[model samples]
Target chain A: MIPIKKQYRRLRSLLFALSSVIMFFIFWELIALYSPSPYVPDPYSVLKAFITMLTVGDIDGYTLTWHALVSLERVLLGFIVGAATGVPIGMLLGIKPTLKGAVTPIIEPLRFIPPIAWIPLSIVLLIGLWRYIFLIWIGVFFPVLLDTIAGVKRTSITLIQMAKTFGADNKKIIARVIFPSSLPEIMNGLRVGLGVGWMCIVAAEMIGGEPVGLGRLILKYANLLQIDVVIVGMITIGLIGLTLNYFILLLEKRLFKWRVEIRA
Target chain B: MKKAILLESVSKKYEVGSSSLEVIKSLTFDVNENEFVCIVGPSGCGKTTLLRLVSGLEPPTSGRILIFGDPPDPRKQRFGVIFQEDSLLPWRTVIGNVKFGLELQGYKESEHEKIARTYIELVGLQGFENYYPHQISGGMKKRVAIARALAINPDLILMDEPFADLDAQTRSLMQRELLNIWSKLNKTVLFITHNVEEAVFLAQRVFVLTKRPSRVKQIINIDLPYPRARLSPPFISYRERILTAFHEELEGI
Candidate 1:
């Protein structure tokens, strides 16, 4: 049970956040009223559009929910593949300096190129979903890879020494000590990678000739001067990104409870 | 009595920049089976280095270190080492940390919890078995380290000022607890500490060392029985002797 003082503090913070959001919508409504621009839809119009997109089918041959689901699927698949491959490669490079030296020169250059920048080449190389996946994978890969490597490198020497003195072989040491020790950093990597992947998926969908994705819907509606639908798409993307980040944070809290308690 | 460890002319030198610094200079000592021995020296006297060399964590520049009539190899003969640092795995609970050595040894999964719990209880941490290292006090964390070490059931234990981080009262309490456990287990122990009183209180024999490039200065035997009184005449006299030997080295420097 929370104390009254703590409960009051939490309630105050919540009210503060809610008021700021309400003020933002009011400011946006006032701008819409004064400007009378078709491009800048009012908050109420966007909300109505959001509900219409939710209930009605055939916005762009599919409902808004379908478009959001398709985008989420692509991002999820791309992020999973990126993490699965990147973590192992990163662990290998972290443990084996010679291999890192050999591969770093190749990867270092590729890391600088933004994922959205790869859309043209990805389209030429692949078709439809694969192109979007490729772009999303590129977006997710580098952060996870670099962070995993850094985490592995930062494992405490004392922990490693302790493992070794207990007669642990190289494999056991990595599995038991280094991997668990590097988890917080790896989780950070995944969080950052997922955020990048979300953005890349939206950008990729806008140009990848995809018919049913939130990004494609926004692009289509904007071309037709349906500003409310476009705003709905934009808001959906933000909400989904926020939800994904919250899920990752929840996982981190569960897994690294010891770490959290230590900081507290 | 059987000899548990024998170090002959062990020397360790570290190469800093271009010049090499000798840390342990031709140090020679032997610890018997089931004996509790402490090495007391001034702070930063290469005492930890000596333990590291003995444990084969680091190699000596020159000398022979034998454990039970063989060269010291962690794989060949297990030696539980408790470092000055808590060294508890933050992610693991008390029982989990205690079971770590057993897991590395590839013991049966079924046996781990039981064995770990036994040691945890032995270290007076029965109720805190599921508590993570971060959740425990410094003294409790040290107890976890001890439990982890003892759970391995190693041939010998090498401790490097394991209680040095605790407060004076907690340090004395832990020393007593350690003595209780050691007597019951009859484990061979080589403890390193800068505290002269701690050395005399816990050890059957105390080896005093010089300040830097440390060599064995003297070995004093504490003839007092177990459950030694802190204020007793013999205990005080032994403590004084070790203190004087330690101060002489400091003064010479």
Candidate 2:
């Protein structure tokens, strides 16, 4: 059980967060009232637009949930594809020092080019779904690869030697020792990769001007001066990103029960 | 008295960047079946390197090593190794870590579980079989490593300073428990340590090694009986002898 003092501290922190959010909304409302421009819609107007978009649908006859689903599909598809390719290649390179060394020079330059920078090339060369996937792939691939390599390299020499003394061959050693031990790091890589993929979603949808995505809806509404709807789109993206990261954290907790709990 | 391990002029040289560093030079010894031998030396005297060579984890630069009659081939001749550091897989439960060797040997889950449980019980960790390495104390972790090594039913067991990290009280308790287990199992053990008292307490014969480019300086037979009293005059003399050898090596350095 948590001590009373610690619990009280936690409660105090929660209250502080709630008060800060209230303060932000109040400040925004004051700004909207004084501003001459129509672009800065207050928090209440954004909330009102959000409910209407969810229930009554937007002007294009599609609901906010539909836009969210489209964005989610792109993110999930691209994330899965990127992980499938990245993990195996990462494991191969991680196990073979010579292969990693040879590949490093070529990959080092490419890794520096972020997902957004690939936009111009993707828009020109890729067609339809591939363009979105390509952009998100570029975002997700490197972190997962690098983390997996680090995890494998960080495998304890003591454990490997112990395994060898038990008469374990290379394949058995890798399967029984290397893979399971490296999982915590791999999960961490996946979480970071998913975050990058979600960040790239806005630019990815912007590439082809996709008709149904949150990114597209935000831009489309902004063009018509519907600042309230644009704010709703932005809020949805933030909430979804938070939800995705929370989901990964929960999964990590369940899978790695042996890991020391780091409750910061 | 069958020879379980034989080392003939065993030497290990590690090439560091440009220059070659010799860690072990001409270590010749034989460990008989069911005998417990300890290699005690000053720190960085290549006690670990010698163990690595005997376990076939590394090849000797110019000497021959044999397990039983054949060359030290880890894949062909099974050996149990316990490292100085905690090598227990944090992700595995006590039983799972013990079952690791059986799993690699292609034993079915059902069969391996029974074998693993026996060793876990042998190490007095039966009730804590489900506990992870992190959940246990340091002493328990060492026991789990022991159970893991012994579960494989290896011909020889090589331990490198297995209790070096334990508290003094726990270390003494563990030593007694280890002796109990060793007598019961009748397994050959080649243990290494830097502590003179630990060598005197555990080993039937203590092989002292000199400083860098280490070689056997003296092999002292512990003629003392089991449950050997640390405060006993014989035990004190044994400790003094090894300590004096260590001091001589330091002085030479």
Candidate 3:
């Protein structure tokens, strides 16, 4: 059983979070009441729009769920492709300093350019699903690559020495020692990569190739000046992002149970 | 007895910025098969550098190191080395850590598990085979390190103050345990330490080393039998002799 004081603290934090969310809605409603512009809808109207879009189909005969699913599929595919390519390239660069040095100039410039900046280029060079995948891939790739490199670089020297003493050569040391040691860092990269990939969905869907994504739904409703419908789409995106982030965090905890956090 | 390890005029120097800093100054020694030798020195006296040279982790600036009539090369030779710091892989469990060396040496997975289990039991960590490095105590982690080293069945084992980080009680307990393992296995050991008492208690012969630019100042034979008493007159005298050599080196005498 948890201590009484700890339980009390948990309850208090829960209440604070609930109150904060309630206060945000009240403040938003007040803004809608006093606003001269019709773009800011009240929280209640947005909630109604969400329920209607969930139960009955929207103007495109597709529910909000279908749009969110489309967005999720794009994010998942992009994130997987990013990780598959990033990990091997990152490991190669990490192991060979000369290779990293030669490639750094080119990758450095590309990494700084955001996914949104690549929109026009991707649209012109790619078609349909590939366009969205390319944009999201751009957002996901760099973080995974950088994190994997950091992980490989940060492996304990003592552990490497220990492996060497046991008649392990360079290849064996990398596979057995460096790889396992770098896993926690690699997992962090995947988590960050997924978050960035999800964020790219909006810009990806807005390219006009895909018409059923949450981002497209939001854009369509906004064009018709149905502010409540747009707000509903916005809330759905926020919820999905939160869920995705939390899912990866849970996976990290499960995979690395040996990790001891030195919390004060 | 055959010479398990032979070092002739081994010296190591570091190039720090522009000026060179000498750490080891022409060290020469030999450790025989089944012998337990301890090198005692002041801190930062290149004792670790000596061990590194022996394990072939680093090369000496000059002189030659031979293990069983061959030059020591970690990639080719089977040498067991436990470092001064914690080196057990945190991602691996006790058994997994022990099996790591075996796996790298190309032993089949089915064959290595039993071998790993034997070493785990030998180190008195049988119950904690499934426990990770973080789950075990300092002494236990040290045991896992020992087991990992021993699992490779190396003829020469080098330890760099393996119990230096333990508490006083745990350090002594580990010292006794180490003696037990060393005697039972009958393997050659070249252990490095700063504690004169620890050196006297564990070694068949204690080699006293001086401060930085360190060289072997004295080699005192410890003729006391197994389970040597720390409080005994002979043990105290051996400890004092090594301590005097260290103190004289510190005083520049």
Candidate 4:
């Protein structure tokens, strides 16, 4: 409650974080040195491999940054395409009875089939790079679509009636009230969809090796028995995923501050 | 007095399995300008159904409703409604919730800002303009809902058990504040409640309904003086008459 206590708490948190990093690195490096096999490299050696991947361009051609960039571009493009259509489709289905009934049956079944199942069909239909993009798009679209619809449906009937009584037309009610009210759920869908998209991309990249990506790099190292390099690639993937999720959360906080429940 | 709201032979029905259940039966009433009309009845007596019909939220199965000499056009007639729930927009500040109807009615930004500020102060939320609905107490939220309706300056205000969720202390305060607001604004109010004392306290005329196929059991005019004393002989007599009628109506149901 007091200013002094708040400052002390912040300093304590900073110290705790610093000690955790030091202790974790020390234990990891110490364990790797006396290990029985080459699979578990020392933390220092893994760091060296990470540096080589970044500075000298790992494997044959591309650098670590190159793989991360390529992966980022694919996911971002697929997410944009998926959300651009998914949100409106979801909203339309939720609001209109006839549309919901007709379309929901189709969506209900299609959503259950894993995006991986369409790999062969996608390869048969589309050319090289587009296949991977299509798989990622499919992975993201359904979760986002379903969640958006659920959110719109959950809007309170009283709020709708209130808007209607106050002279809000169908268009104004949808655009102004329902859409903003549904944002928290739509954002939730997008978050889940992105995770599915990430998983789909990794599976596709490893199997197909169609482009420069972390998934492809990890696969390349795994095949060559460079387990440490593979581990490095996987860790980078995790870190990048964390960074992307953090950005989404930041955007959510800024735009939908109302969704954050007031402490009072 | 100028007539603002009128219903003629209005009734509503809903299909129930193999039979049709009629809710409102040949109900007709007129709300004069600046008059406060309270509709009180036993539970499931279609008090809510009548309010919805008047506000054009639900259409009567048979009869027509005319507001201001024309069929009620929701777009042209911006009515304010306070439900049992506060119905405050969760994302908005106290002022934002108050300004919602004004914004939808195309009131200019500056004009609404002034009006919202004035009304927020009126509802005793002067320092809570930036507080979101979730941050406010239940009583505070109710006040904001009241302020929002007032800011819109609707020709009619329909309230359905608006104080039902509030504590007795808060409900009494809200009643006094509501009467003060009614005296100042003079909007035709159609308030629905089941509390006998509440109906007797607030209304010019209390329209009681029968159980199912709810028709007007009786429309009792409160001849008790304004600023009514609760212990007065006339007030108690009117309440006793309504309760006795309610008892007979319940027995029939």
Weakest ten-residue segment in model 1 chain B by summed lDDT: B70-79
Query: Candidate 1: which stretches are off by over 4 Å?
Result: A1-7, A57-59, A96-109, A262-264
In order, the Cα lDDT scores of the candidates are 0.89, 0.89, 0.90, 0.84
Q: Is the docking of candidate 4 incorrect, acceptable, medium or high quality?
A: medium
Q: Give candidate 3's TM-score.
A: 0.94
- DockQ values per model: 0.69, 0.80, 0.78, 0.65
Candidate 4 residue lDDT tens string, B43-150: 888888888888888788998898877777667886888998768888888989999989888889889999999988888899999998877889899999989888
Candidate 4's C-alpha runs over 4 A off are A1-44, A207-211, A260-264
Residue B29: error of model 1 in Å?
Answer: 1.2
Angstrom error at residue B191, model 2: 0.7
Better of 1 and 2 by DockQ: 2
Candidate 3 residues lying further than 4 Å off, grouped into runs, are A1-9, A97-109, A262-264
Which is the better candidate, 1 or 4, if ranked by TM-score? 1
Best by lDDT: 3
True contacts kept of 1: 0.68
User: How many collisions per candidate?
Assistant: 0, 0, 0, 0
Ranking by DockQ: 2, 3, 1, 4
True lDDT of residue B121, candidate 2: 90
Candidate 1 at A77: error in angstroms? Answer: 1.1
Error of 3 at B73 (Å): 2.1
